[model samples]
Target: MLFARRADWKATKPDNLHEPVTSTKGVKVHYTGTRFEPFLEVHALCAMRVKEIQREHMEGKGDSEIDYNLLVCRHGVVFEGRGWREQNAANGNRELNRAHHAVCAPTGSGGYTDVPEKMVRGIQDAIAYLRRHGAGWEIAGHRDGYATQCPGDLLYGHVLNGSLDPGVLWDGGNHIVRGGETLGRISVRYNVPSDYIILANPDDLDASGKVKDGMKLWIPARGVPLKGADPTPGDDATEFQPFPGAKWFHEEPSSPIITAMGERLVAEGCSEYAKGPGPQWSEADRASYAKWQRKLGYAGAKADGWPGETSWEQLRVPYVGQKPGDFEEFPGDAWFHDQPKSRIITAMGKRLVEEGCGHYSKGPGPQWTEADRHSYAVWQRKLGFNGSKADGWPGEYSWDRLQVPEDDD
Candidate 1:
């Protein structure tokens, strides 16, 4: 493989940097987010782009050094972006970044999609390099980490389908994505988070958060256990708080997640239960969740309504509304407090329609009208969360019943 070390690129000194990453789940696929010219010569243009990313991280973003451990140029050449001895800034948040080494795509990885074959190969080379070292087999995209769209779509599509995987990741397993699937949805299938799916199959999603249908992805056999409820998040809590994922299913019971799942199932016209879609993954909830699963071409065990990450995501259940985790840290703030008009409100409106909760003769939109609030209030009351929780604000408990992606809002 054609490899260019950092020395080959003549990189500049960085202002600051943290300790070298000690261990990690694996590599993360990233794009420059800027459109660079593709080149046949490989070294020159790709090297310049690598240096440019370093400058952006250090000079523009005011970081210690280049955030990535390595980069792949258009001609399938692996150029060292941060070589080693630096923690990546692009992975997830602080603690999360420690679990990953960053790999960036050269010129063709961003903006205008359709990552070149050569660039894809270069990314593979970078992963292979990381693998040769101590990097784990997991490979996730930027969107899988935080809420940004850095890698772009085309390349992310390749990741979903497996053009970026090759022999790098362990055969943890493969998941063939069905229709209406996202990384979040796919993760739900395996009872894991979208981030786990990304790390297990880094090539599957682009930074913009677009996923490909019928894409066969890698599922990590093991990793971080899903987080349960947090008592105090930002204050004196010693435990770092991560947003709930399929962990909602495996870990301790999250009433909000359970409620959100039930609400979303009802909206999707999958509820068979005469009564409760209550919290705590019940038999009724499974039956309803399974109904929606069958609609996705899942059958038998696949459609058994246990709420896998893929189906949960496909269900578009908003897991944030009534969960213990506060929305103050995420988007859709006013959403949990007031039924204000916003993207999250719009999503809630749509979820309400799916649950047959729409009062409007027309439909829901971005603006939250009295009708929307009332409709949500009605759903809340039906779910047994009456009183202030059912004031139509769709608190953590109510939002969990809806199961909508926090960022999806």
Candidate 2:
């Protein structure tokens, strides 16, 4: 991992800043908003993006320094910003500022088109590194908890798709109702068919395709790629189902379950996604699942998402952020104590952070060292553990206290 430190990017030191905040939630993915040229070289293009974003955050946004905690360049290099253990000004509100770290990816000259594969990997790597340390697992977009579209549509789809981790708010349909807003108008706004909006909220629409002045709706994402074209579909069940799924792309967020599956796959080290394991099942999921199946000694028809009961039973795992599951081996302190750094250790660290028991100099590193033990010990002490129980290793008693949720549903 080629990590560019603060000096490497020529970032200005934060001045006049007081009482730095720590994020207890997860991370937020931000985009440059404005378009830039496609990256030809990592050093030149990435550095320019870092400089410009920092300048805008400090000068225009009126912050002490850059808003984000890091920037993932298009060539898969992670540029440090406020670094870990500091507050991010880019996360919408003051409370959210204290809850989440911010990371930015550049979408370049055409605004939210296909971002480079290297850049997407870099973003995921940065998130993994943060998860290894002490960041929470709730990955979100800039506009997820805020109003403005700072991360754009295409990139935000990945955020919804669980690119970083779990707790992604499903996208392409959250909109506020305003005065004179009709089902047709809302459909136009989100680029979805009016029929989708009607299906998302049947009771809210009027007979003439009108809408109440103050009725909120989950407008499914734009189905009709053809702008100004008739979205009129025959009254059929297939027409009501959101995206045209005669074909599926790995790049779009379509549903909640797909996002959950993607998150689990990412934590399991199957990152074949460029955009999402978001709302929709894409080529990424198939490719990732195929790798997993390949690892599991499966061949031919026993690959990808089409799995039998035996495959499902064998591929069990504990969700990092979502609801916990019945794993044959629950990753506990033994998995972390003196054990090598891995995804299990990272998940445990994220849970530790959520419990407000992190105490590492830099981060909850992937390495199963003294830091992770001490952090868990802190939480154990909070649970009134003493003597052997407070030895900084996770025990069932303390693990239960942490209440790691299982994504059973």
Candidate 3:
């Protein structure tokens, strides 16, 4: 029988495809315990393996066709097997037969091994195809859904950690930046606060506060924080005290705002020469003025590792025109107080959507579009918010956004 080359394998459904199964719960990935003698011959071997599976199902096991829904070879070829609509008998458990689709990876050995780039891509494509077809599935290793270690340790590790899956692949996490990566773009891509990225790698600090490609700073695994420590000044205290000389912006004094604002100044191309109010400015009226200057991008604002006057002017206050409690109805003042939650801005609106802070409904009121969800998910992951099912919703994890420090440098 003629076998199709792995390279030519497309994700098309078979002409005799069955109706798609409904309510897919998860995916089961396997590793074929086979090795290719020569790397170049791997694709052919993979094609042959597909034929073997079909033969086994058709004759030996007395089944209709291949038991697996898809197969990926070391060469990165993807082959449609039983077809997702058809019930697969690959796993011994009957419950999984109705809710899971089986995908197999060609393992060089029975144990841990490096999956070829091609094969990894093929697996990602297969998963993407399945998800697009309304499969309510999360990628899983065979060990997750079955009583077997069929996909092996290496593959299993990626699945458990939520890495090397369709989401990361299709969403641009696969690309490696050499040096030209700007913190703004990276912040938008990963939905992380740009300031946090700079804080993580002060050495990457450019005069403009953005990281350039080939800068060699570590992109913390998505959802991992920079220092992996509290960004807030006083973790032990509930109420925040004003830094000496720094005027309190609010009567209660919000620590999160202080840290988030400081980080934002650093990201918006602030210079390091700027001076933070320090403990002195903590209670000074000029502190808010300093923050306003940093936000406005005043000249000389450098993330140069120092908060100075140039940074202060950039964040210069936007002319509130009225005192805090004046009943004259200052729209600007209200806008300032109701600035859509500073945490929301720092975290990015999209990130808020991912955290499920707002509903993803068809209309508005905190609902997000597909692009919004996708972008925010990426950003949330970059900020080390990994494993947070909330994605961008304001929850306990998002509270961490408030904990960022003001003067860590």
Candidate 4:
């Protein structure tokens, strides 16, 4: 999805502003943490909220724009907040403001909500854009750097688990085969199961497993590749490598190892072919790798599939730096609890109730009251469940029904 640039903000520039110090310390993620009523004008509401945050910051409370350097809406639209070179007051620490880049996900009082997949991809794209333009480091979510639940729970989990795999084709559609493509070749190229390719392209195959060239075939965007035995003699020997060093590519954040593998593959043929980060990998890189792999007689010459270790070793690729999944630090699981609760708790409670859980209650504190019971009932009903009258008693069926697994153990 393409993002429309914020021309209005681009037209205005601050005077004599000191550029922020760009360091690779960490990335910070945040939530707008404001209540957004449905059916209201979204853009206007967001603009108003941004203004309010600016007012609070300028009143000697923080640096002047909304606390984040960028804001992502539920609809997946990205808006500019603070300039990259300017300090932001959104995070509580001034020192962090100088070193960290901030990005905000739109959320209400709820800690975090469903972030549109497109928005997540857009965030990755923005980070890549920033890095290419010399923002000085890779991207990270707000929870990564500080103790807070800013980007929402689901998204935070995606980043933590390395599952989101930003920068790949995410439209989740089917691809049609062009001329000069073979099923076995295409299947290996995309890491898609051969059966999946066959099933998707039923019209092209005969009983003998023959597929004619130029036949239209349906290929699912996200599918697992078929694993094969090691390439035999005369098989292409080119391997997959990744970009060198800790440099971040805007696309494919999840599989850094593959990127490194691709880099090594190129280096094997021509040392000059392996260079440091210049821009996001282009079709040229894919074409070059394909040429090398084909010349080496490797079966996996196409650049459309996820890379595995076998692909790397067959092409004589070396693992570079830390393996893709390695990380030295991570914010503790209870990070979200530290964010000011003015909006998060209320929103999360309401969401829980809306999802068919009833009588939602906050933690293990002793402040239970009739008001809490009433709120719980309302939340339950909103979630489309039958809620009983307000009853402030622990172990009540409604209370039990409403409990969510706590992140803190």
User: On residues 194-313, what C-alpha lDDT tens digit does candidate 4 reach at each position?
Assistant: 554554555676434566655666654431111221111110111122322333432545443444434444434422234431223555445555555555555643543323334434
Better of 1 and 3 by TM-score: 1
Model 1 segments more than 4 A misplaced: 38-43, 108-112, 168-409
Which has the greatest lDDT? 1
Return the TM-score for each candidate structure: 0.39, 0.39, 0.37, 0.37
RMSD of 2: 23.5
lDDT for 293 (candidate 4)? 58
lDDT of 1 by residue, 171-287 (tens): 357878777787776655554435445544546664355677788876654322112211111111111112356556555473644655565566455777776455566677767
> For model 2, how does the per-residue alpha-carbon lDDT over 346-371 read when each residue is reduced to its tens digit?
56676778778887777665578788
C-alpha lDDT of all candidate models, in order? 0.61, 0.60, 0.47, 0.45
**After superposition, candidate 3 runs with Cα above 4 Å error:** 1-20, 34-36, 39-41, 108-112, 168-409
**Per-candidate clashes, comma-separated:** 46, 14, 71, 30
Off by over 4 Å in 2: 21-23, 39-42, 108-112, 166-409
Q: After superposition, how far is residue 14 of candidate 2 from its true place, in Å?
A: 1.6
| Per-residue lDDT of candidate 3, residues 259-368 (tens digit) | 33343333333323244312121433233444445455543433222334344334421111112221122122233233343332333443344545433443222232
Residue 247 alpha-carbon offset, candidate 1, angstroms = 67
Q: What is the C-alpha RMSD of each candidate to the true structure, in Å?
A: 23.2, 23.5, 26.0, 27.9
